[model samples]
Structure formats: C-alpha cells, structure tokens
Target: MQPFMNSPENYHILESLDSLVQSISENQKEFFQKVSEIRDNHYTLVKSYYEESRRLIEMLKETAFLCSLMFNIQDEKSICASAINILRKLLENPVAIRILSTSNSHTKLEILAEESSAAFSIKSLCTKSPLSCIAIKTCRPIIHSPLESAVPCPEMMESPEQYAHICFPLIADGVAFGCINILFEHDTDIMLLKRNIDLINILAGYVSLAIHNNRLIKTVKKEALTDKLTGLPNRRFGMEALQNEINRSKRYGHVFSIAMVDIDHFKLVNDNHGHTEGDKVLTLMADLARKCLRNVDLVARFGGEEFLIILPETDIDKACVVVERFCRIFNEASLSDVLNAKNLTLSGGIAQFPHDGGDVLSLLKAADERLYLAKNSGRNRIVAGKLN
Candidate 1:
C-alpha cells in the first residue's frame, strides 16, 4: 500500500522463491528414487547371500555325514559316490559339474571341481576359447571381468560362450591338489561374485581336509595292522587276516596253509648286541622274509622273534614248497651286516587248515606245537605236523 513501485520488485522476488521451491521439490523426488533403488539392490544382495549361506550349511552337514561314512569304507567305489553327491549339491549349476581329483603326491595348484561345459561354452564363442587357460591361470575363486566385455576366444582354447567362471583350488598340507570349477549360464556381476570367493575358499579347505583326512586314516589303519619292526603283520593282525582269508577260501572251496616261523637264534643276537641292535636285526629279517614270499602270502610277526605266514589258495604240498623256500631264504639272511652275527637262520612249522584244525585256535595251537617240533627236529628245519 505504501509503494506500488516496489510491488514489481516483490513480484519478482515471489517468482524467484517459487522457482527455488520447485527446484527443491524436484531434487527431493530424485533423491528418494535413488534411495529406493539402493534399498532394492541391497535387498537382492542380502537375499542371495542368505541363500548361498543356506547352501553352504547344507554342504557342511553332508560333509559330516561323509566323514562318518568313510571310516568304515574299505573299497574305492563308495568313496567316489559320496564325493559326487556332495559336488552336485554344491555346484547346483545347470552347466555340467566335474570333480578333478588328485593324490597326495600331486602338488600343483589345481581345481578340485570343474564344469566341462565351460569348455564347451567357450568353444561355441570363438572356436578357440581361452576359458580353460584363463580358469587355470587365475587360481583365485572367481572370474567375471571379461564377461560384461568379452574378447575373442583363443583357437587352442575351447568353451561354448564368451563366459568366464569361478575357479577354486583344492589344497591340502600346503600342496595344491586341484580346483573345483563352477560356470554360470549367464554372466554374474563381478564384485558380487568376487565377494563369494571367501566362501569358496572355505569349501575348498573342507574338501581338502576331508580327502586328506580320509586317506590319512586309511593309511594309519594299514600301518597299525602292519608290524613296523618286521614289515609283517603283527600277531593279532595276522590272526585276523588269516581268519578273513580262511572265510574266503571256505566260501570258495579253496585250500590254504598257515606256517609258524621262529628265528633259530634270535635271542643270542639280542643278548650280544643290545635290544636296539636286536631291533635292527629283526627289521632286516622281516625285509628278507617279505622278499622271500609271494605277493599273495600274508606274513606277520606273531610275537617276539616269531612269525606267521598264511598261504592262500594252497594245499599241503604247495604249502611245503613255499615254506621250504622261505626257510632257505631265512637261513641265508645277511644278519652279519646288521647284527654282526656269524650266521642267522629260521625254522618253520607247517599246518594245513581243515586238516590240522578246523578252527582258528586249533590251527594256531597245532602250528605252535609243530614249531616246537621243528626246534627239536634240528633248529633249522620245517616240521610238517598233524594235529596232536
């Protein structure tokens, strides 16, 4: 009311204020939209992570089951089956999943699992896919960089698509065993894929541990049943082994023989050279005995200075020939080299099963008594025995 002239100025000011308000409103709308998008992306990531975590937990449980199963499995076929089931579950990819296996002796950075379909896919891309080498080279868990922007496949290389894959090395005891390869049908975002590498490492560690532990347990069991001193089966183990062989032979209607072996003057050497040297002499004798016998024969140290040899699929006559050969070999042992002894010799007593005795105890007793007879027969001869 005081100044009409200033009204124009006020109007201009109002117009500027309106424009600022509109600009502010527009900016707020854009900010909220961006925030919503971020939340959606975050939710998707979290969901994927949770799903993968669930899969991992299930895989670990299966590993536990496998651990228990391996304890009793002696044959190799069962081992393969258990491992395959686990891999299929872990990969769960439409692409083929392959497990690359290695031994304790194999010491190369390797993939424990592979999808040959990656090879096929890459080959389809350039007829020469570099996928195989690329997978082999990275040794890290995943490879997704070249996917969004892929190059031509190498001629020597072979894969079906311009796709990349995840490669995890299966390692144990600081040894690179092999790798497990996982390929996706579609390209995955690199950063997200890379984040899962830690989980892959965890899986690889478990795989290595399971395989190595199983193998170690089997080896330890074998060593436990074997005599370290004589490279033979110990008394208890031999009896057990003999029982198994006997059962097999009985089932097949085959014949087998058991022989009791006694070192002729083992005590004299032990008495002269102390137990340590005595141990060495015993070891040497064991090696000699093992060398003298057939691969199928089961020889064991029954006790101090005594051994048992079981010949499968053999009757009395055939048993005699083998026993005599072992006797001759024992007599010619290089005891002098180890015990510094003037001479070394062994005597054996032969007992044919189902002839000398029907049961384990009876056969063992008959063999023992015959062993004494061999000592009486002249400390270095085989005494073929009939049951007392």
Candidate 2:
C-alpha cells in the first residue's frame, strides 16, 4: 500500500473519488426537489376531490327535497308557490313563475303565480314577443352574474346592474312552456349559481311536469262536471252549486233563489224534430240563457230539456225579474226554424232559500211543483208560488 501511494496513479484515483461524490450530491438534491413537488400536487388533488364530493352531496340533498315538495301538490298555484319558495331559499332572492295557456288555438304567455317579495313584475320582465326571452327561445338557462362585464340578454338588462338575474326555461319532453325567473337582490356569487345550475334545471323539469299533470286533472274534472251536448254544467254540478249556495246562505243568514226551467213540450219536439233538431234547440236555449244571466248566476243543464239556475243574494222578486228576462229572450230568439212551430217557449219556477224550503231536496221539490203549475196554466210563463 505504501509503494502504490508513492506512484502518480494515486493522485488520479483521488480526483476520480472526489468527482463521484460531487455528482452523487447534485442528484440527491434534484431527487428531493422532485419529491417535494409531488407531495404538494397530491395534496392539491385531494383537496379538490373533497370539495367536489361535498358539492355533489349537497346537490343530491337539494334535489331530493325538491322532488318531495313537488310530489303531493296537485294545484298549479300551490306547485308554483312551492317552487318559488325553494328557489328563494337557494339563492336568497325573489322568484316568479310564468306559464303558457292555449286559447282558441293561440298560445298566450301569462304570469300564473308569483311571490309577493318579487320587486319587479313578471310581465314587465317579459315582452310581448316570446322570443325576447333568451332562455325560452333557446330552451336553456340564462345566468347573468355580477362578475360579467356585459349582460347578454335584453331581459336581464331590465334589472339593475347590482342585481343578478337567473332564468331557467321550464322544459319537458322538448316543450318549453314556461320559465322560473329569479331576481337576486344582492350581487350573487357566480359560483353559487354555477355549482347548483343542475339543481335548478331539475327543479324546472319537475315544475313543468307537475303543472302539466295538474292541468290534465283540472280538465278531467271539468269534463266530468260538464254536459257534452249543450256545453253546460250537468245535473251533478247543478246540485253541487245549489248545495254550496244553501250552505253559504245558511252561514251568512242571507237569501238565494233557484229557478227550474223547462222547454215547452220538449218530448213532443224530440218526437217531431228527430232528436238532432232537439239538440239544436237545447244548444240554442243554453246560449240564450247565458246571454240573459249575470256573471254571478249559474245555469246548468238539469236534465233532458230542463236547466237549473242559481241566483245568489237575490229574493223571489228579483229572481222573477231574471226569469222574466230569460223568458223574453227565449221568445224573441228564432226557434221556429228548428222546431217548425212558433209555439216553442220556456216555462220557469222560482224558489227562495229559507222561504220555500231549508234543504236542497225540499227547495228542488217546491221549484218542481211551481214549474208544473206554470206548464199546466200556460206553456210560456213563469210561476213563483200558488197561482192567484
């Protein structure tokens, strides 16, 4: 070992050892730096994942609550009120609902229901043209944030810059019939709405479905209570109206009147005019009765050729005025063309609550008796009581 250390090769071996140590030191520093960077990245990823999971769970909870709220409500107004409440809770702002109605085959946009806290009218925000609403036109949601430099939609521009507007088109089965409009009183954070946008969308869908189902229910109920041939309320509905009037009169100590009207010799007309013409006469009578009666009055088809008329807050004398007016109108209307006779006329009998009878059957029986008297005495007149 001493002999080797004395040679020049010893110096070269020491230099090589020193170079190897320096290279190892440099590589160790780089490896530790890379490890530190990887640790930080993993923490960031974990934090991001946690945040996302929390948001997803919150969204699921909100969706479940909304579905539960919309489940049992059958009234359209009640459904809208529930929807507005949930949206207000979420955004801490006022909400409004607008629905589409078709009349005479024309679609009309109207505000069906809204919250009282709403600062602006739903009609004011919506223009006459449905296309003006961006959400409705595109069948998508429009989010106007305080952070945005420019408001994209004109409807959103109607609100002050300090207020954030969110509009979600209520679409179901590819039909955009309505929208849920929220006007945030404060400058809402864009992320709050963005994070819950899907929740809002699901809410909109539930609203549309609920409203559609409600309308179907109402239509079915209306059809059930209405007569198909004469387009008037049927006997069952007439009885209901009479009972309601009786209850209201009894509660308030007021008086109401009911009139039993019968077409003169309706059986003879049907036998002679072949039922088709008889139907025409019935329709004509309904139209004429509607013209003669006031808005508060209810005229329903009682049976074959008879109609029941309810007059609220009226006495026998006032009810006679109404019955007489109806008789005049019936006489003046052209009935000869359908019946081939000039004798077609109307006979009516009037009865008042608490005066004629207390209950529905008693009042109906009294009215029927008077109606029989009118028919026996004269076919074209009204009977209020025992003929004098």
Report the lDDT tens digits of candidate 2 across residue range 60-132. Answer: 6986677677868987778887877776655544444344332223254466666645355545665344556
Clashing pairs in 2: none
Segments of candidate 2 deviating more than 4 angstroms:
1-37, 92-108, 114-123, 131-167, 172-174, 181-192, 335-343
Best by lDDT: 2
- What Cα-based lDDT does every candidate model obtain? 0.67, 0.79
Residue 236 accuracy (lDDT) in model 1: 77
| Per-residue lDDT of model 1, residues 42-139, tens digit only | 99999988997897677567666665565465544454455556555544343544445544443322223333443453223211222343433455
Candidate 1: where are CA atoms >4 Å away? Answer: 1-84, 92-165, 169-199, 273-277, 335-339, 385-388
Measured by TM-score, how close is model 1 to the native structure? Answer: 0.67
Candidate 1: C-alpha lDDT: 0.67
TM per candidate: 0.67, 0.81
